[model samples]
Target: MFFSQLINLKEDDSSMQFIIITHDAEIFDDSSVENIYKFESAPDGTIVSRL
Candidate 1:
């Protein structure tokens, strides 16, 4: 519900920027998202990648 509202808000106001950290992949399913970063724990250390 919150995500849906956020998406609508973004559409209404183009200037709004949101940085969201979520475990649910459904958030990334939105077509509005152009860039996605994934953080994962590796044996050596934490790794960040663009998806």
Candidate 2:
């Protein structure tokens, strides 16, 4: 509910920008969000990639 509210607020306010860190793929189920950065574990360290 709260997550949906945040999206609604962003839509209502054009200047609003949000950076959400979530493991839920549902966040990407909508087109309201643009740009995605994924992080995963690696043997040496962490790997960051743009998805």
Candidate 1 colliding pairs = none
Q: For residues 1-51, what per-residue lDDT tens digits would candidate 1 score against the true structure?
A: 675686775645566666778898686685577778888999999899988
Candidate 2 lDDT, 1-51, residue by residue in tens: 666676676635566566778898676876666778888999999999988
Off by over 4 Å in 2: 1-14
Clashes of 1: 0
Clash pairs for candidate 2: none
lDDT of model 2 at residue 8? 72
State every prediction's TM-score relative to the real structure. 0.55, 0.53
Cα lDDT of all candidates, in order? 0.75, 0.75
Tell me the deviation in Å of residue 23 in model 1.
1.1
